[model samples]
Target: MNPLEKVIWILVAYVFGCLNGAYYVGKLYYQQDIRELGSTNAGARNAGRVFSRSAFIVTVIIDAWKVIIPLWIAISFWEMDTIILGCMAIALLLGHLWPVQLGFRGGKGVVVYLATALMLAPIPLVVCGLIILLGYQLHKNLMLIAMIGFSSIPLNLFIFYRNIELTVVFFMMLSVVVIMHRNGD
Candidate 1:
């Protein structure tokens, strides 16, 4: 793709990412901002803690679908290159974590990463999910469980895909989400 088209695609992904599901769901369903409830942040776990199960489900669907739709459109329909795909992945996460609408505050960013990883590597994501499930059962620490889950992406990329740039992208995305969640925003 040309430079201008690449920038436009990345910008589209970024804007789509800025659609904070948890924040909006909370506001619409309960008339209360999700960031001001429970953990006082706009994230899946916080949304689950504060809102109903159905509301949390909607938030998850929104988060995942927002990434998946544009990504699928770009890759399958638009046929974007690896670099543009990587840019979309990074931009989506950044927008999710630091949306301008929320005053540069947004979700923990794990779901967005999960969606990206799932789209890029479903088998690895499955294995990672199982491991995370087991870890959650053993330790009961959400943060640690997520970190362990996120670790599988890099492992999958290095082992299965063997793409250095993608490996690096997975590592960076994992770090960003983990740090965002740990830092409480």
Candidate 2:
């Protein structure tokens, strides 16, 4: 893709990601902003806590599709390279973490990150997901399990792809999520 096309695709991904599912669901169903309830986070967990389990499920679906749909379309139609894909992933994450329409306050970007990870490295994502499930079953600690699973993405990417650039991209995406979560966003 040309430079302009790349920019456009990245922008599209950001805009799609900006469609914060938790906020919309909360507004439409609960008549409240998700960011103003529960943990005050516009994320699936917060939505579930403040609204209903169905809200959480719907938020997950929306957030995942927001990343998956645009990236899939870009890949299928444009066949973007790894670098452009990496940029797009970062843009999507940024949009999720700081949607412009929501006063730059958005979700923690876990769903967006995982959705991109599924697209970029399916095998690693599957392996990590299984590990997360096992860890969750064993310890029943979401935070610890998530930390372990997400931290493994870079190593898994390197092992699977044998490409430093891809590994770096994974690391960058992971860093963004970690930082956002660390900031309590």
Candidate 3:
């Protein structure tokens, strides 16, 4: 495809990614805007806070699919390539966090961030999950837990997959995720 076409597809994916499905789901099911509630995020965590655990589960499922589906579509249909898919994943994560449809603001996108990382490389994802859970259990602080998990990305890269490219990708993605999560505190 030409550069113009690639740019268009990327933009389309970003726009689609910014849909805020969880927010709509919350509004439709519970008659509430998730952002107006708990953590004031249009994502699953806050939805789960004000709504039901089931809603949070559903939100996560949809949120994961959002990134996966777009990447899959671009890879299969547009033949854009995996690197672009990674870029699209970041775009989707940012989109979910700052949805244009919702005044360019949304959730923390941690679930989606890890979901993207998992799709990119499973081992790091697993390690990160374990670290986050363990840290949360020990500290009872989500930010601290996330920081521990985020900090462990390099160890996860060294211990599991030794691919330098994968390591760099994981770390870069982790950095973006952490930056996006700055507001979590």
Candidate 4:
């Protein structure tokens, strides 16, 4: 794709990412802002904790599809390369984490990261899932298990793809997630 097309697709991904499912679900169904409730996080887990299981499920589906649809279109239709896909993924994650309409406060971006990873690397994700299961069995700490699973994505991506560009893109994606979580957002 040309530079202009790349920019446009990245922008499109960001806009779609800005469509926060938790925020909409809370507003439409509960008549409240999810960011103002529970853990004050506009994420599926917090939505489920604050609202209903259905809210969580819906939020997950929405968040996943929001990333998946745009990436799928770019991959299948436009035949975007790894760099373009990486740029779009980063843009989407940034939008999800700091939506302009929501005063730059938004979800933690875990779901967004997973969704992007699902599009970019499905088999590695499954391997990570098994690692997560093992981590869970070894230790019951949610944070530890999550870290173990998430931290492996880059390595797994590298092992599977053997492309430095793709691996670096995913590593950058992983860095974004770690930084966001570390900031307690």
Provide the global lDDT of candidate 2 against the true structure: 0.88
Query: What tens digits encode model 1's per-residue C-alpha lDDT throughout 1-185?
Result: 67888899999999999999999998888999887788777878789888888877899999999999999999899888777888899999999988888998888788899999888767778988998899998898867786888898888889887977778888899888777766643
Which ten-residue region of model 1 has the weakest summed lDDT? Answer: 176-185
Q: Could you tally the backbone clashes for each prediction?
A: 0, 0, 0, 0
Q: What lDDT tens digits, residue by residue, belong to model 2 across residues 2-90?
A: 78888998898889889999999999988999888888888998999889999999999999999999889878988888888888898
For candidate 4, which ten residues in a row score worst on lDDT?
Answer: 176-185
Worst 10 residues of 3 by lDDT: 161-170
Runs in model 2 with CA error above 4 Å? Answer: 183-185
Q: Give the local distance difference test score of model 4.
A: 0.88
Candidate 3 regions with alpha-carbon error over 4 angstroms: 76-80, 133-139, 154-169, 183-185
Superposed Cα deviation of residue 110, candidate 3 (Å): 0.4
Query: Once superposed on the true structure, which residue ranges of model 1 sit more than 4 Å away at CA?
Result: 183-185
For candidate 2, list the clashing residue pairs, or say none.
none
